[model samples]
Target: MPTNGSQAGSKKEFQYRTQFPPDFDDEGESSGYVGFEHIVGTLIWASSQASLNLFEASNTVEAVTLERHFTVNSAPDNWQPPVDIWAQISFSWPVENSTLSLYGDEALCDLYHSETTHCRHQPLTANIVTELEIVYMFSERLVSHLDSDEGIEKTAR
Candidate 1:
């Protein structure tokens, strides 16, 4: 879960580690990314950056905006424990491959170019919902970290 804003009416979202292979020549790469519309976030009792950007939730039933709000604690034994357990991520159908459809809301489809921006908030009208789904539109990459105290400290850094 991520830390909420300092004040009410304020909002924040998570930024998952969706870096890159920069290019993908097909061949399904199994290890990278979160949906752009989904927001991944983290939290702390006080202010500290150990909290990692995990995943996010959709804003509406249609998920017009990214809103991942939840909480996780900084306990040693539980990768992320909660003084009280909270939801860290909100997911949708897994991403498929990249290809834009022109028949839908062209503007939003156009606006979301990157992996995260590929989807947007829609009215959730009957016509807007679909039985279809799309893939990541991009390839997934691998991420690695050294397992040690230094690695833990680096997460904060």
Candidate 2:
């Protein structure tokens, strides 16, 4: 990872790892494990990391917008034929205004392209915005704690 000295103030590194069960075989040389658990776990873990990164990046700049594009090149050996997993997520945060917004206009094609679908354009209430800010703050703290060396040592013990 590269560092932006002026924006970041200091360089900080974070690492994440995924552990698979001993019985599980990822390669096809042996009987490959047939389950969605690992895939789901990886997605969840990546989402957490993305959230943390977004939070940190947003703090340095006025606003940060992120779009994650996922493509599935191949499916598990046990999966049935014709499996397609392609999705995109767009999230934005304006820290100065304490606003966090998610735009999924292109996430689901059917709903997004349908003409009959009526999307509301009402601005969120003050209370709702406050709640979102609180959630963001909490997530930042939780991610920081979980990424700390002390937290890792505690979990290991």
Candidate 3:
């Protein structure tokens, strides 16, 4: 189960170990190489916001399927137990003779760039909800808005 704010090891230091290919260079490839720390941090922050109540009640979406399939714990009334939230990561690999192409890279870059450019708050807005949260109107007919702009904005339909 995932948690919001202080719980769910959000304050804990994140550590990861990487194993490179057998022919990969060690020292030369190590320094001056930047990793996806910000992206990973953003994802972890986003998971904390993926509340079932927010998804089901506030967003007006049927989440029974998500609850049934992904939830390992079902004690919603009890705040003692954190509600289960799932974050799925799918990777694309090159086929036998083909090369791998990451088309999503451009999309991610665009999103991050938009967040930086358009969002009023710089980095904190990436994690916590503020007035800077970018809101997208999917359809003019679908005119449901939260009474308060306290929760994270839904960027997609």
Candidate 4:
């Protein structure tokens, strides 16, 4: 189950790796390049933020659902475990086709100039290249209630 903060059984783990295309450098030696590190770091940071936001939104929706099910006079004696949500998200950007002008080559400069004269770099266009999987679990009683025709009718109402 996914957890909040440093609680036990937290499913919060992050892994990141970067690869530069062979054409990123003229001689195919990316070791001497110094600018890409920042780009990769920024991508990682942004992806982390996006993951956190997704988690937060899921939690918020779960909380709202629980609260909506409670009423003034018939509150349950105990609350069930919150719905579990987990994500394995990945972000990828093709460096070779990047329009950021990270390189100072004349071809890139000419392309940038021909594309736009704003001098501001293009926005990083990253693809979320993984499926967002969310899992939900409830107590047996809650599941039974949820599966009942009355529950379905109530939800329809």
Angstrom error of the Cα, residue 31, model 3: value is 13
- CA lDDT scores, all candidates in order: 0.27, 0.29, 0.26, 0.32
Compose the digit string of candidate 4's lDDT tens values, residues 51-74.
432222211112332211110111
Report the error of model 2 at residue 143, Å.
33
lDDT digits (tens) for residues 2-56 of candidate 2: 1111122222221212353333344331112222333334544554544421111
Best by lDDT: 4
Model 3 Cα displacement at 126 (Å)? 24
Query: Please, what are the lDDT tens digits per residue for candidate 3 over residues 1-157?
Result: 1112212322221232233322233323211222232223333344444542222211121244321111111122323423333223321111210110112122233434542344333223111111212232232222343334556766866
Rank list by lDDT? 4, 2, 1, 3
Q: Against the true structure, whose TM-score is highest?
A: 4
How many residue pairs of model 3 clash at the backbone?
0
- Model 3 ranges with Cα > 4 A deviation: 1-34, 52-87, 91-157
Candidate 3 residue 157 C-alpha distance from true site, Å? 41
What C-alpha lDDT, on a 0 to 100 scale, does residue 118 get in candidate 3? 43
lDDT of 4 at 71: 9
- How do the residues 1-157 of candidate 1 rate in per-residue lDDT, one tens digit apiece? 1111112222222133333222322323222222222222212211134343223324333344332223222323333422222333223332221111112222333344532342434322112212222223111221122233443535443
